[model samples]
Target: MTRSDLNNWLIDLSEINSIYIFSGSEGLWFLISVVAFVWFILAIYRVEKNDHTSIEEELSNPEDLKNLIIEINSDEVDKNNSN
Candidate 1:
């Protein structure tokens, strides 16, 4: 067809909902974004489950652990001094 005939056909197609395919592409983008968001949430959940020990609890109970280390170090120093 001539260029003017093709242009006329395109103009006619534009009169109806030209957003039919455009909105289809938009729906696809929304679906992809949703899937990516869900994947990110699941990854965070898994990491939290695997390594979610509380730092506050550990820090709160440090006195006993510190005493144990000090006792061990004293024994080591005594042995070295004796030798």
Candidate 2:
């Protein structure tokens, strides 16, 4: 958006007197919260991506996959019983 349009949107979204969002020094808190949320999502995505990549790499060995499946099932059963 143009500078004016961006400014108007920000004003509406984070107005000093608006009841929807905090104002004053809380502006810094709002910015930090947004950054933290984005970081958390990216971290989760990276972890899941790595897990899938590792599993695909390991799947190259058929015997290894069979063993891995047995291990995963055994762990699940153990966890269920423990809980």
Candidate 3:
């Protein structure tokens, strides 16, 4: 189908009536509502916690990590002031 034909089909579908709510058993409705509420809360939390950090920040923050044996050996040699 062409782009114009698909666009016309979508426009025709937009005229149909759609009820967003379902009037079913109380237990089913409650379960669906609870799930939807939890999902919305989690989405909000992730958005708040997401931050962009630069690569420089990550590379410079390795002091908390223990250095390897080679680093320790180099430090000892430097302390002794050997060639």
Over 13-60, each residue of candidate 3 has an lDDT whose tens digit, in order, gives 766454243423557888989999999999987766563234345446
Candidate 1, run of 10 with poorest lDDT: 1-10
What TM-score does structure 3 among the candidates reach? Answer: 0.32
For candidate 2, the lDDT comes to: 0.77
Off by over 4 Å in 2: 1-23, 70-83
The 10-residue segment with the lowest total lDDT in model 3: 1-10
User: For candidate 2, lDDT tens digit of each residue in 3-45?
Assistant: 2323354455554343443334567888999999999999999
Model 1, 82: alpha-carbon shift in Å?
39
TM-scores of the candidates are 0.35, 0.47, 0.32
Model 1, range 1-83, lDDT digits (tens) per residue?
A: 33222334446665556433344367789999999999999999988866655644554678966887799999999999999
Question: Quick one: best lDDT, which candidate?
Answer: 2
Candidate 3: give its CA RMSD in angstroms: 14.3
Instruction: Give me the runs in candidate 1 sitting further than 4 Å from their true place.
Output: 1-24, 53-83
lDDT of 2 at 80: 100
Itemize residue pairs with steric clashes in candidate 1.
none
